[model samples]
Target: MALVAVVIPTYNESENIGGILNALSSLAGSAGLNIHVLVVDDNSVDGTVEIVEDFGRRTGFVSILRRPGKLGLGSAYVDGFRWCLRNLGDFAVAVEMDADGSHDPAQLPRLVEPILKGEVDVVIGSRYVKGGAWRGGRLSRRIISRGANLLVRLTVGLRVRDATSGYRAISKKVLEQAFSGERSYETGYIFQVETLYQYYLLGARILEVPISFYERAGGKSKLGPGELVSFAAWCFRQLAGRISGRVI
Candidate 1:
């Protein structure tokens, strides 16, 4: 059977980690998915590491990569993807998910199903797509999220509806191509957009699966003003490169 590695980046997500793990564990059995949950923790001061460790002990499928200090989200996924490449020789798909419960673990099957069927090289759990909705968030946040995505769509010219969504399942071939050559430029949330853009450049087939995005159930959101600024700056740089007719 082919294996799927779910890469979850964490920092101070103790409250939601265990429950998400348990939920994924339950779904794996029912869906008959040979899934492994890889939590890439950025040395959270909170007990996030402890919770993952305990869960790993009880559930052999859960493993973790503990970093020395807090790292950006893009690097966290890059590290996790490299680990999967080295260790999971049978890996067929790699998934990106949040530990904050904003992404529904139950919808994982929907995210990976198309990839398993060889329908697409990437599957994005999108909120802006048809049938997708952003369920709960402040009006300002919603506007910012929508605006950022629109900006990426216009600048990068990516056909993806949700270019910034972290919830996605990437085929092994696409993952290898995206990570093998030059390293990613952005290390923050903008990495999400960078990855999608890279996949597009590689001519990989992409699909968007509608999903209702929920507010984080517990703990604090890691996104801040700095990351937002970084994302905007990266987008502008990409736009400049595009206008200059240079490959980004």
Candidate 2:
């Protein structure tokens, strides 16, 4: 069986980590998937690491990398991908997901199947696609999310509908090429856009699998005004780079 490493970057998510791990465990067992979860934590003081440690001890399916401080999400995932590549060398797929219960663990199979079948190099659990729905976000938040995605699509000419969606899976080749040598420009949520844009530039086959995205059931949201500003700046930079004939 091909191993799948689910890289979940977390911060202060003690309440939700256990449930997310448990759901993944159940899904892996029922589906007979060789799924290993790598939880990259940013020194969450909320006992998030303790929960993951306990769960890891119990199931032995989850392992964690504890950082010294709360680094940005992009760096967290990059670290996770590097760890997976070095540690679980046989893992064929790497999945990027949230630890705050916004992304349903049940939809993992839908996100991963395409890559396993070689149908696409990346699979996005998209909220803007058909059969997908966004639930529990406030009107302003919804507008910001939609507007940001649209702006990226127009500016970068990215083909994916939900460029900001983090619920996605990538094949090993895609992961290595996406993170090879260069660091992501946006450190926070905007990293999502940067990663997807890199994949698009690499000419990876990308597919969107419709998914229902719920608001976080516990803990605080990581998105903030700073991330929004960073996103806008990154978009403009990409536009400028494109105009200058420098492929970003």
**Lowest-sum lDDT 10-residue window in model 1:** 178-187
After superposition, the stretches of candidate 2 with alpha carbons farther than 4 Å from their true spots are 180-185
- Candidate 2 per-residue C-alpha lDDT over 1-248 given as tens digits, one digit per residue, 9 for 90 to 100: 98999999999998899999999999998887899999999999999999999999988999999999988998899899989888998988999999989999999999989899999999999999999998896888889989999889878878779999989999999888766566655568888988888887799999999999998888888888988898988898888988899986
**Each model's number of backbone clashes?**
0, 0
- Predicted candidate 1 versus true structure: per-residue lDDT over 26-114, tens digit per residue: 98998889999999999899899999999899889999999998879999999999889888878999999999888998899999999
Top of the candidates by TM-score? 1
Clashing pairs in 2: none
User: Superposing every Cα of model 2 onto the true structure, what RMSD results?
Assistant: 1.2
| Cα lDDT, model 1, residue 214 | 90
lDDT of 1 at 127: 95
